[model samples]
Target: MMLSPSDRIHAPVVLLVNPAAGRGRAGRVAQAASEALRAADLAVDVHETRERGDEARIAAEASATGARALAVVGGDGAISHAVRGLLDGEAGGGARVPMAIFAAGTGNDFAKSLVVPVHHVARMARHIAAGNTHVVDVGFVDDVPFVNAAGFGFDVEVLEHMRTPGVLRGTAAYVSTALGALFGYRGFRANMANDSAIMSRKLMTVFANGRCFGGAFRIAPDARLDDGALDCVTIRDISPWARVPLFARAMRGTHLTSPHVSFHRDHHFHLRFDTPPMFETDGELQQAATCDVSVSVRAGALTVIA
Candidate 1:
């Protein structure tokens, strides 16, 4: 279905590209997406991110300028940056615009969660031109917004290990780094509290708004984007040898049934680590300034063309 001619856009759709994403795949995706949008008779304004925080800045400017929509060509990290920008604008009373995501990152976890088409550029362009939109929830770690999962413990170590260059890329790189991390990475201790209960000695905990993490792990099998809540999954302290089977089961989302793991659903949570810790939100590393971090969900906070 398409929007009526009367509803057609008069403003340009801002195309924000992160050239470094997916080992430079985003540049090619941006080119094709731009061509497709132009062919569909939609005006496009292309911009490339050169530095660390460019995605959010460009997205904020686009929304503030009343752009028709913001089309992001990148992976989960880039999209998360854009989400933060959009939400920041919303909080400041700027125009709320729908986002079009072209997944060009290694994991592409957020795009997968939203069922966004990865290869069909022309179809996605048509969706954008038609103004097709869907509202979804957004998760916040302290003040930063994320469209996917916020991870702690083991996954943070996996990301740390990935800092060194290797022959592998994409999901292969993630898995290989994770396997390497398991050998030297011992679990961290934290206290997790929600509206219902408080638990301690957590090895890893995920505040999931999306179903998967690190490309392959179905960390939260039944999470829903618009559910107005989060799926909190935690792994308690276990021996490194014992974690091998747990890792295997997590790939299929069957680890939830394990005694060492626990799952709950809630709208808000407060997590306290033994010390300031490193964590990740939608594949972006974050350093907590203090030992305490708060997570909450904002229902229908984002509009996306899926």
Candidate 2:
């Protein structure tokens, strides 16, 4: 990750606060997190983000320096941005930098996968100082990298519904949007092939780098962060009513047993859609340049504070 002009100050921790992320609570989380770090006698520099790409730009800047640890005070999108900044081109394949997280995003799925409790902001701060790093794999769709989960089909539609302003939070918000999207959303025709999977009409999915999405829905029960592969869980088209039970089972991670679901894991996957596909990576919506995508793994590319 690189630093911005605002991040020129020296501190043991370079804290990136995404003020606009996850409603309005990120500022509070940033304040509380800094207090915690200062309380531990560590010099903390809190850099509040002003725009969308600041996270990546500043993170890349910080990484270019010799900053000991970089912590993010936002949801997974902020993390995604910073990771992209850090790994942009040669930076990703070079010497790695450590990172910490203070979960303040709505989904916080990626943070949760690292077992970082949003409620324990101080502990997360302390972990930055402790600097015990754990290497974890990062999944990539072409050149763009994602920290948690990424995919298309129903998940993309669910994300579209999630974009609507609502009063709910966490899983409840996701559930409300998912239910609304389920009614009218239809799957796209697609073909996929990987070392562990080869299929067509594989219209839906929740390809995971971690265990879950939608706040705790276990998208992949057997996923391991350091496993050196991505877990691909594809869902065949089913009745909207049938989706209810399957989604319920997903909560407990038993949906894999369903006949409509197929599971595979590999270092790389190739996908082609009959039409262009819109997707999401770490809760951030995206679209592919063409009807094809190549998803690959950067085995243990990130060293996270856990």
TM-score of each: 0.93, 0.90
**On residues 76-165, what C-alpha lDDT tens digit does candidate 2 reach at each position?**
889999888767623654335678888878878887678655558878777776667798999998777998999888877877766677
Alpha carbon deviation, residue 139, candidate 2 (Å): 0.3
Model 1's TM-score against the true structure: 0.93
lDDT of 1: 0.85
For model 1, residues 79-192, the per-residue Cα lDDT tens digits are 999999988876776778899987788888877677656568888898898887899999998888889999889898888777766646679888877777776777887777
Q: Runs in model 2 with CA error above 4 Å?
A: 1-11, 89-95, 164-170, 195-203
| C-alpha positional error of residue 279 in candidate 1 after TM-score superposition, expressed in Å | 1.1
- Which residue pairs in candidate 2 have backbone atoms (N, alpha carbon, C) closer than 3 angstroms, thus clashing? 1-59, 1-60, 1-61, 1-63, 2-59, 2-60, 2-61, 2-62, 3-61, 3-62
